[model samples]
Target chain A: MTRTVLEVRDVQKSFGAVTAAKDISVAVPEGAVFSLIGSNGAGKTTFVNMVTGYIKPDSGSIRFADRDIAGMAPRQITRMGIHRSFQIAQLCNDLTVEENMLLAGAIHGASGPSFLRRAHDPEARDRAVATLERFNIAEHRDRLVPELSGGVKKLLDIAMAMAGDTQIMLLDEPTSGVASDEKFPIMDLVMEALRSTGVTVIFVEHDMDIVTRYSERVLAFYDGRIIADDAPDEVLLDPEVQRYVTGTPA
Target chain B: MRSKLFLGATAAFAVLAAGSVILPDWAMFLCAMALAKGLVCLGIVGMMRGGVVSFGQGLYYCIGAYTATLVANSFGVSDIFLLTLLSALACLLVGMAFGPLLSSYRGIFFAMLSLALSMVLYGSLSKMSVIGGTDGLNIAAPTFLGWAPEGRPLQTALYIYVVAIVVIAGTLMRIYFDSEQGLITLATRDNELRVEYLGASVRNIMTYNYVFGAVLGGIGGTIAALALGHVDPEFAFWTTSGEFVFVAILAGYLSVPAVFVAAIILELVRSFSNLYFPNTWQLALGIFLLVVIVLLPNGLGSLVGRRKGNAA
Candidate 1:
């Protein structure tokens, strides 16, 4: 078994008694494609927020690399080689694509000579080009983010996360709102990028095919708790996950 | 295109600075004051670019002016360089302490809260008669290296104006917005949750922004105090803060040079309004601002960028 990279124990979160997450516990091993599958309000986003230090759980401990990162702020956590992309592609709309990638690299504390061109430099133009090429949007590097289509924006958002030199990436519905045709390609590119970069991926996705295709391990969330954590086929076959997700086994 | 814009700004600054040498006393004075106000507006520009509006900048502005005025008047220390440095440090502390509180609020609430804070300082100053309260205190011409001005009022004002432009031009705060910290600042503006998830302390970034902004306001205030030769409680009024906001909107959230451009335009409006339409200049100014806002929704800075982009 791969060594565990993330551990969550008995985590609970509530907003004035409207419990968002309850007793959610899961472990993600290093270098694995971990998918957290859930319906709306299954507390999947909330759980992601908790692990990335966006939200502090009311009662629980989250350990990443054996350090309890229960209440740390997101930026501090980002400096530690973890990064996340928003569902809405939270990019600097006025900036060029290369600038966005450079900013990501800078945020992850990567800076040196030829910071914008060296292959290893996060801010290197080559790295941004590689990301844009991987996402099939290399032609739009000089363009502003606001001018891109929704699918392109989503792709660029993930590319920016890749540029950040992240060791662990938390992607929230990376394929959501994307065109049906572009979905698989984008997911393939993202999964391939993660595989090439050797970054541990924990993505929250709703589509079973995309999740099953990209994810090696699946953690099913139902009613704000993890109901099944196992291999993709096992989690898909689990009776509890089927009942909670689709009202029947797949 | 960006390089061209920077070049154009440098040229404009050169023209403005050179004009002071030949312009009339009233014209030079107006220009000098415009540059000073432009510097203050630059701080507002930075905050606004990051999607936070501060309506209380006058708090730091007033604090800066008072720090310099108090030391100069009470201790008879009139050194321009020392006074400016000391006052900026004082404003930096005030900004650091007060900035953290407003980092959590956004939109009108943040604006209003900042406005109220400045008003508090203004109110307190009015009650404290020792600081001359409502009347304010008069300051002598700043001594440069202990060399007293030889009754060269115009020359002295020109010197102050040059300093203001140089400081404003050299300011690299906007460049920081492009840095990692700057992206985080912008991220906080776009999506706080996403910024947090990226492992950045939104609050700390905000705090950092506030401290730098306060330093900008303090620098501007110090220059204005030197130019005006007085420091008053009115400097802390909400209207003063509002004026800075208006200037920032006029400049768009871009380079420091843009702020000066807007400030110069405003100064000309005030001057020409008083000159040709003295009776209704304020109303004319108000109408002009409305038109600018309506025409250039993004700001005058956007126009500048567009023109330069097209040219390039």
Candidate 2:
């Protein structure tokens, strides 16, 4: 059996009158590519937030490398090698694409951010460029983030999250904002780049085609609970998943 | 790029240092005062890069002047270097004590909190009779190391001393602005949440930036105190802090060297306008600032070259 990289047991979270997560539990094996599918307000992003420590679960045990990170701060969780990219690309818009990548490398470098070393020192620049190149956005490295295309920004966001010894990456919506024709190409680039690094990927996606194509396993969420969890083909065929998540008549 | 900036800064420092020989005594004093105030404005620019503006920088400025004056009067320390050192240390301690609290604030809250703290200091200092009450205390002419120069020589020594300090501070700050931590600060300004998600503590970064600002403010206060031969609670007044903010906004957040250039310009305009316009000098300064703001929205530093993403 593949070793589990992330284990969430009986997680429960609520926001006042609304329940965002209820008894959510799932175990992700090392190097597995899993996709989360759900309708709006169906607790897909909530699970990612809890795992990445953006929102503390009201009660749950989130184990990553034998440590309970259920309520840890986002920065601490990030330092421990669990990084996540936002649904809306969270980038430094004022910085050039290369500078943004350099910042990520510098922050995650062995020495951390330094007062003495230049941010774009040769070593850091090479690493940043390499990551940008891997994401196929190296051509736009000199352009400011706001000037870049939506697809490139999303790619940069994922590329930045991939920096520093990341073992598990949770992409909220990698292809949400990309144009239809460009979505498949961007996802191909992102998946190809991510898979080569052997990092376990957990992506929340609304595109059934992407879910069927990229993910090995699928977790379908409805009303803050996982309605079905199985192979993409099996999950797509499940009556409850079709009715609740995909909005298709069963 | 780094080497080019270093060479340019060194050349500028040399030119300013040489000004002591050709400039008259009054001009020398004016330049010294301008540079000293420029140092305080530099601190404001530092905080501005981190996406917060401190309206109470006068708190550290006043503290530095008083610390130097107190040390010289009570402990008999007359060396300018020693006084500036002590003042910087004092401000560093104060910054450390207050940084964590202030780091939690942002936007207008941070500005107002800093302003309130400085006003508190101003009120306390005004009421303290032992420190000469509202009249303030006079600081004696400071000695360089052990040498005591009188009159013109003394003014020249102080002018050269201010020039050297400004150059050193400006050069060091330029390196800092280009450093990894400095880039993190600029990133924080743009998207703080993204910075946190990148595994860096935004609060810690803000705290460090605040402490640096405090230390620079302290040093500037010491230089100003020495140049003016006096210390007063007015140093902590809101209006005095407002002048530092004005210089910072005028300088923009782009370049460290532009900060001093803006300060020097403000001082020159104030002096000349007072001579020519008299009662309308404030109006003249206001008009000049408006013109600069309207023409160069990014401040004079834009004339140099725009560095992508707030690179100082």
Best by lDDT: 2
CA deviation > 4 Å runs, candidate 1: A14-20, A111-123, B1-13, B153-187, B306-312
lDDT of each prediction vs. the true structure? 0.76, 0.92
Give the runs in model 2 whose Cα sits over 4 Å from its true position: B308-312
Query: On residues A3-26, what C-alpha lDDT tens digit does candidate 2 reach at each position?
Result: 999999999999999999999999
Candidate 1 displacement at residue B201 in angstroms: 3.0
Residue pairs that clash (backbone atoms under 3 angstroms), model 1: A74-B199, A74-B200, A75-B199, A75-B200, A76-B199, A78-B199, A116-A124, A116-A125
Candidate 2, A208: how far from true, in Å? 0.7
lDDT of 2: 0.92
Q: Largest DockQ belongs to which candidate?
A: 2
Note the B-chain TM-score for every model. Answer: 0.90, 0.97
